[model samples]
Target: MTEHKPEKKVCVFCGSSFGVDPNFSKSASELGVLLSNNNYGLVYGGGTTGLMGCVAKAVASNGSYVHGIIPEALVSKERKNLDEIKKMNEELKESVENHRGATPLDDSYGKTTIVPDMHTRKRMMAQEADGFVAMPGGFGTLEEVMEITTWSQLGIHAKPIVLFNIDHFYDEFIGFLGNCVAKGFISPENGTIISVATTPEEVISKLQSYKVPEGRFNLSWKNQ
Candidate 1:
């Protein structure tokens, strides 16, 4: 059996809105299940709506740890979703009780931390996670993904970063990245930092097989 790295956690960046495509949400939930089955914890933007909620619920229901980091400003907005997640977890536990042959569920409905600001939320998330995955999302998700990728470029960390391209959502971005390499904006070697995965299984596989790209640029305090 492949040894699972239970200590490693993945931070997912995605929208709070359930996008038009059903697959986006479906993929998010599937990713959650995959993470739980593989014994990997999840760290994500603390929210109960859209992809975030779907993924969080799946992980918690499947008896895995989930850490949600949210800015104080958005906690109120996510309260309803939080309540729903709690209810769903409770129901799942009740259902599990009827099946003695099944494994017992953990008391991990997941916890949410409210930070003062977005910067603090992101910093805490980055500190908590060993890797990152970008799902279909809007500007906020894109920014988070780019910032983390930039951190890798500066050698802040060499953790694997993956783009979950469900329904070809990230096709344009991937093309844009290739264009960057072709245009000499980002070198071909460095462009390999952001990996692309089409399915949840592929995402986990790529993450496990990932290696930090060698001969990449490094930043120094003196340079900054």
Candidate 2:
């Protein structure tokens, strides 16, 4: 008899909003489908709108499990679409009516379980996922990705942190990391903490091959 390996769950951090570009949303949906087809579960924020919702919807439609973590206060607020912000009040009213009685937007549009708060959400997702992938997002997304990267650098965790650097959104950030290496604030070798990819297919390939090294380091060198 042959034994089968369990499907690994991946934590994906991405923008709640779709932004101005259609490519971002398209890529997000593609990633969801890929994860589902590969038997991978998704761990993400709980919302029924934006890029978050798009990814969640794709996974659920493909019959995969999704785990969503969100702060309690932001649950209702986060459900509103980002583009809705630019609309006139009258236009917003008309837009809401147009989509009325449509799919009852729920966390499970992608078959998800929602958690509350940032701390709890991060902890749970970190614990549950076999790896992590970060798509383009704003400040909140950057914070989440940084936290995971820090954890990996400290040897507190051993999961891959893949960056979906769509549209060169992360180009400047990558440059800043280089500056850190040059200034002696971080070891150039620590740069291995993340893998950057321009496409969803590359992101998956990087995650599958990532391996974290053993041991943690102190910042004594920084002081010296």
Candidate 3:
């Protein structure tokens, strides 16, 4: 008997609205296609708006798996994207025949899992992903990536985390992390848990080769 290995998924954190820079959206789409071509599935906040939707659509259209975790509070806002994906998949199913073990369009182009609240949505996203990527985004994107990195620091999970520094978007944030390390708020070793990648190709490469940094503390509730 052969064993079945599960597909690997990378959770992407990005803006719900397209930023002023055209390159931001361009990078998001490129990353999505790159992820698909590399045989990695996508896990993301279920928004069809901005960079979030751009990446998700690219991945889906490229015949890759896209699992979106959305909170109920924001479902009304993001529902349109889901609908668009479904319609697009339906059209593809009608026009194309299955080849190369592709999933049937009627079956599922991708899926959206709606949770009751933000916490649940975030928890589910974290649980589902094998790695993490942060694109140019607002506060939500920042919070999501940082929380995941903090989880890595706490020994909760050692998954790879990369910051997609599109057009040097994350330069200031990277400097902030450095300042924290310099101030001793964050150890230099711990600082390496989050990596910086300026290009989508670099993002994939880093995720593939990432190693958990030294000095990670294992927390035990029993001791607490």
Candidate 4:
């Protein structure tokens, strides 16, 4: 029997609005291109604006499959970047046919699944991704990264969660984590659970070398 393994898919969490820094956007685009060229699959929010759209377009341009799962309400708004979506959809079609050795769907390549609500969208995105990366973003991006990182700390998942700290956007947050450790909020060991990288190349390399810690385990009932 022939064994088939699915390609590794990375979940990218970023802002729907572009921040003031051009470096962030450029890094996002570069990461997308690198992921595609490196044979890494992508799962992201279906927003075709800001850093989200930038990354998606880069990946699709390089002929990689990007699966975007978005909420129903935001679907139409994302339509503005239809040009990139169109290219991604086409690339997805070719990838399905040639790489996966499967029949391609009539569906467009910027493959998006419109979920009923934000909760479902995030859940589905997390479920589909084998790993995660958080680029420069606002509240939503932070929420996604923190939730997944929390899951990692709880021992519920062992997937690597990396920070795409472009332009030092996440410096304050990283410093807060240290403060948490110093104040006894988070364990010193737990502080190292999340990896940090300043560039796309560093992020990719870190993810590739990531391995689950040997002694990590879930918590037990409180002794109190």
Query: Using Cα atoms with residue i matched to residue i, what is each candidate's TM-score against the true structure?
Result: 0.82, 0.78, 0.82, 0.79
lDDT of 4 by residue, 1-224 (tens): 12123278899999866789888888999999888767887898865667877887777666777787765454343244445645553322221111113222223325666567888988788788889999988778899999988878877778988998898889999999999989999888888888999999998997898876554568752431
> Candidate 1's residue-wise lDDT over 1-224, tens digit each?
22234667999999877899999999899999999898888998866667877898788778777877665454333243445545553322211111112212223447656567899989899988989999999989999999999988888888999999999999999999999999999988899999999999999998899999975767663532
Instruction: Estimate every model's Cα lDDT from 0 to 1.
Output: 0.78, 0.71, 0.78, 0.75
Q: Give stretches of model 1 more than 4 Å off.
A: 1-5, 77-109, 220-224
The parts of candidate 3 lying over 4 Å away from their true place are 1-6, 77-109, 220-224
lDDT per residue for candidate 2 within 115-204, as digits (tens), equals 445687788888889999999888878999999998878766778989999888899998898899799887866877888999988988
The window of 10 residues in a row where model 4 has the poorest summed lDDT is 91-100
Clashing pairs in 1: none
Clashing residue pairs in all predictions, respectively, total 0, 2, 0, 2
